[model samples]
Target chain A: MKNIKVLGSGCANCKATFARIEKVARAKGVAVTLEKVEDFAQIAAYGVMSTPGVVIDGKVVHAGGIPEQQQIESWL
Target chain B: MFEQFAHFLVYQLGGLSPASQLGTALHFWVMDTTKILVMLVVVIYFMGLFRTWLSPEKVRRVIQGRSKTLARILAVTLGAMTPFCSCSSVPLFIGFVEAGIPLGITFSFLIASPMINEVAVVLLIGLIGWQLTVLYITAGLTVAYVGGIAMERFHPEKWVEAYVWQIQMGEIAQPAIDTSLRGRHVFAVSQVTEIVGRIWLWVLIGISAGALFHGYVPQTWVAGLSERENWLAVPMAVMLGIPLYSNAVGVIPLAEAMLAKGVALGTTLALMMSIAAISLPELLILRKVMRVPGLLLFVAVLMVAITLVGWLFNLLN
Candidate 1:
């Protein structure tokens, strides 16, 4: 199981990123607890200044934008 | 090569007279769209890489407990680099307060983060000349810095919500990252793609307005408004801009349009900055943390500063 967190301020891109993660997790049959960290403090804690950041198990694997499914799956 | 291609593509296809409004509009549209889009990609890529090197923790440490003078400047610079949106405003505001960053310093950061936009920079450079671009940047930074300093001097800390001062968070530790050449390059590429992709439509809309203004507006009409009597245009533009909401990218073309239709550069920029700095939505969001008086003060300070910049620029020109 992986704890995957998506960071954004509910902007369009942020919402899309959240949707994409849910879809990808379901397709892979990955046992994951997905969380959306909308709080800027928590998001800034990961040192990801831009939106739609991805964090897996407390480690930020992506920031500033969305990543490919393959890359996201790899992180998971 | 690019210029010739744009000319051939726009002018050759229509087979219309270059002097005609339609032909001129098409030509302006193509030329501006291409230049702005190319600049947006390249500048965003580089800015993303530059952003990766900066962290909120680093910014916190720089200004934490510093004197008002130093913190004001640092806050403006950091705010310019960080792409902060309204959604993140609450948390960032709380975090800054918790970190013992001064109220005024935080205000500077908040003001600059929205006011100094990279998209605005690229579009300004592409549509207008670099001279005005530099002027806008300098004026923006100065306004942010001075407004913050004034806020600090006035000591409006009492107006902040009580809960803000009460929330306690432990020291934020510095984040460790694997700084490799490849990592930065990838980050930069992703940033360019995401930012450019999202804003391409707004850019198109902006250039379209500019195209119409360029093709149809008369020079004498514009010149008439440029005279000193039209100084009222600055305040009028600011007044009109505050109620509307749009990002810097969406407003650039409108600024160009206004400029084309007989508005002064300073007045046009004042309108754009007001849209960013004193936006109603942004103010409403900040109201969550600040009482009405503080919010009013913030808006007043910005209004005065931006107006001053507009008038100064008008005078200098």
Candidate 2:
């Protein structure tokens, strides 16, 4: 199972990012523990300034926008 | 030329009469949209390439221990250069503060990030002209500089939410970004796609509104507001703009329309700045990180500064 975190401040983009990650993971049948990090402190701690930053297993894989499906597939 | 193309499409091909209001409005919309979109793609791609070298983390690192004056200058300049989304403002704020960057300098970055950017500059040039675009950029940077200084005098540090100071930032490894030539090209292309995708609707709305205003609104209707004696127009424009949440891209075309209807340059510029800079939604987002007093102070400083800029330009013009 992969531990994935979506960091954002509850903006529309953040919500969309969270949804997309879930959808992609389910489709790929990848076992993942997904969490949404809304706290600014935690987000800043990760050094991700842009919202909807994606962190996979303690590694920030993307920031600033929704990740493309191919990128998500590669991660899975 | 875009004008000739628009003329041909609207009149020659579409078979609309040149003198018709629909024809004129359609022509204006088509010409302006085509020109603005083309300029946006080229400019945003270049800006995206430039931005690979400058990120918020990098900006924080550079400004962390600098002298006050130098830091403020750098903050404003980098703020304009950094392609930041308003959604990220809270984290950006906390990140800067956590890094020991002064509150004033952080405010400078916050002010400039939204108010002056490649999209705003490109749209201003496409809609109005380079002269006003230059003035707008100058005025934006000046406001950011002075506003930072002004906010510092109030000891804004005291007004921040206590929770912000309590949270400890961890040492997370920076993700290695692809910086190869092809990687830069891919980044630039994505930027163009994302930005154009996000703003195309707003652009169309703004241009269509301008087109309608151009086709129907009489010059005499706006003459009273544009008249030299009506000094209230500048301040009023600023106040009216605060609630009308829009980015700079969405406001410039409407500004061009107002200018065409004989509105004073100062009034139009003031409205554009206010709409682009001091938005209610952005303020609400900031409020989560700041106390009411701090939020009020930020808004007050921006309102006063923008109003002053409006008046100054009005007086000069």
Candidate 3:
């Protein structure tokens, strides 16, 4: 199982990224656990200043803006 | 229209005396708030559209492998145009370093990124006037350009930690931006609501302070300070502002309040720039990439540059 976390303050980009992750996971039939981290302190703890960060297994794979769907699929 | 609306609200419906404290405060609040919010929406929206066309990644691609002189120019201009924040500092720094951009050019971008941007200029125009706005932009760019060149000439790379050069990051592809008019509308509206929501309290606080100054503080007092023209004011303001962290927008109200209270224009501008560009948190974050000496040197260079600009403006005014 893959632990995937989407980090943001619930901005439009964050919501879009969250939706994209779910859609990509469902399409790929991957059993991934997902979570949204909304707290700024927690986001800072991850050493990410920008929002809409995608962390896979504790590694910040992407930070700032929405990642491409193809790139999300690759990360999945 | 803005003045009329404020007049109508207070004088017509509320029937408050313009001579009264409440009346004056409400009038100031209504007029300033409307002007700022209106500008915020129009400017932020168009800026969003502009941002969609010129992403930071694209900026990185263009600056990469360019000559030092050209890189310095692009870095200053693009850094001002690009929408970036302190949170992106580490990654942005790393990205530039990895792209083979020289330390000097990278320093220019880093210095300019937080200092000069559309939001600050728009707010300055709304609150102050066009003359100061132009001065702010030109001074800010000059600081970044000169500071970058100075740092580059000095060669402070030795103070960088060994690990900063070793960290590697692969570029993640960006999603396509919605460039349609409708898309820009949505983006702009969202930006307005988000920014307005976050800063409304500060805006109110600022207006309240301004109102207080307007009603209670004697004009003679401010003029008195100007007449005395304390030499330490500019340097003190720069020092006080550096440790405080804030964005260009968040600091507008306070800047307006200070100016309303008769602070020197150069001193007020210096305070805002320091708050926007330098902060303890930002310095701590940069700690990962630079040693204490390099960090101190960076601070010293910026402080000197900012102080000079402030003094020059004060002299001219």
Candidate 4:
């Protein structure tokens, strides 16, 4: 199972990103533990200045805006 | 060409007489909506392509240790160019501080990022003209510059959250964006999609409100407010705009309508700047990283600067 974390302060874009990632993972039948990180310090610790950042298994995969469906699929 | 198209669509096709108020308002709405939307897509796409190279990380690195004057200039410029989302302000603020950027410089970025943006610029040029656009940009940058200096005077470093100073930022591998021609095209396309998706409703609402004002609001009432004797207009406009909490995109069309209705330029400009720059939600977010005093000072500085800009423009006009 992949550990996927969405980092944001619960903005609309972040919520949308979380939902999209989950939907894509489920559709791909990929088992993943999804977590939402809303803490600003934690987000900055990863050096991700933009919100709705995606972290896959401790690696920063995306930052700033929602990831595309195809990109999410490739991650899965 | 847009005017002709709107004329054809409203009068020729819809069979609405141009003499009627509803018809005139509908024509204005259609023309402005189409014109502004086209301009937005093109301008935003190009801007996105250019902005793909800029990130907060890079901005932090550049401004980290520059001289005060040089840093302030760069901060405001990059702040205007950077495609920033207010939701990310907290992390961005922490990142800048962790990178050892000055508090004043950070405030400069915060002010310019929202107050002067591509959407506002493009819409201003489309709805109004280049002269006002130039004035708006100049005023925004000046406010940002002066505001930064004033913030630094307070020595606001002490007012930052204690935890923010303690947190050490770690280097993380950033996802590399595709930088080829095709990649830029894709990025720009996505930018257009995302931006238009987010703001289309607001644009429509703005244009509709503008249409109503244009069609129905009497010029004499607007004149009363615009009169030089009415010294309260600018401050009143600034105060009235605080609760609106809108970005520049939604306010420009309404501004255009107000200008057309003979409202004073300064009052309209004040309203636009206040709505774009100060908002309750953004303030609440900033509260996480700044103590109450720092936050209050920040707001006070912005309020005074914006009010001064309003009055200066009013005096000049």
Top model by TM-score, which number? Answer: 4
Task: Give the clashing pairs for model 1.
Answer: none
Tens digit of lDDT per residue, candidate 4, span B1-317?
89999999999999999999999999998998999899999999999888677777778888988998898899999999987778989988998888788899999999999999898898788667789999999999988999999999999999898999988878843535677988878888999998989888878887787788878888788787555546688888988888898888888877877787678888889899999998889999999999889988998898889999999998898
The DockQ assigned to candidate 1 is: 0.27
lDDT of 3 by residue, B1-317 (tens): 99999999988899999998778878877887788778867887788777766766677789998888898999999999987766566656766676678888888888898898777777778777789889889888988998888887678889877766765445433424567988666656666676667666776676666667766777787776666556688899899998788988778778877777678888988898888877787787777678898888888888888888999889888
Q: After TM-score superposition, what is the CA distance of residue B93 in candidate 1 from its true location, in Å? A: 1.8
Ranking by lDDT: 4, 2, 1, 3
Per-residue alpha-carbon lDDT of candidate 1 for residues B124-194, written as tens digits (9 for 90 to 100): 88887899899888988988998888788778898988876766645443433336977788777878888
Could you give the CAPRI-style class of model 4?
A: medium
Chain B, TM-score, each prediction? Answer: 0.91, 0.90, 0.90, 0.91
Query: Candidate 4, clashing residue pairs?
Result: none
Report the C-alpha lDDT of model 2 over B29-97, residue by residue, as the tens digit: 899889989898999999988877778878888998999999999999999898777888998898888
DockQ top scorer: 4
Q: Cα deviation of B83 in candidate 4 (Å)?
A: 2.1
Top candidate on lDDT is 4
DockQ of each: 0.27, 0.56, 0.15, 0.68
TM-score of chain A for each candidate? 0.92, 0.96, 0.97, 0.98
User: What are the models' TM-scores?
Assistant: 0.86, 0.91, 0.82, 0.93
Off by over 4 Å in 4: B11-24, B172-176, B213-225
- Output the better candidate (1/2) by DockQ: 2
In order, what lDDT does every prediction score?
0.79, 0.86, 0.78, 0.88
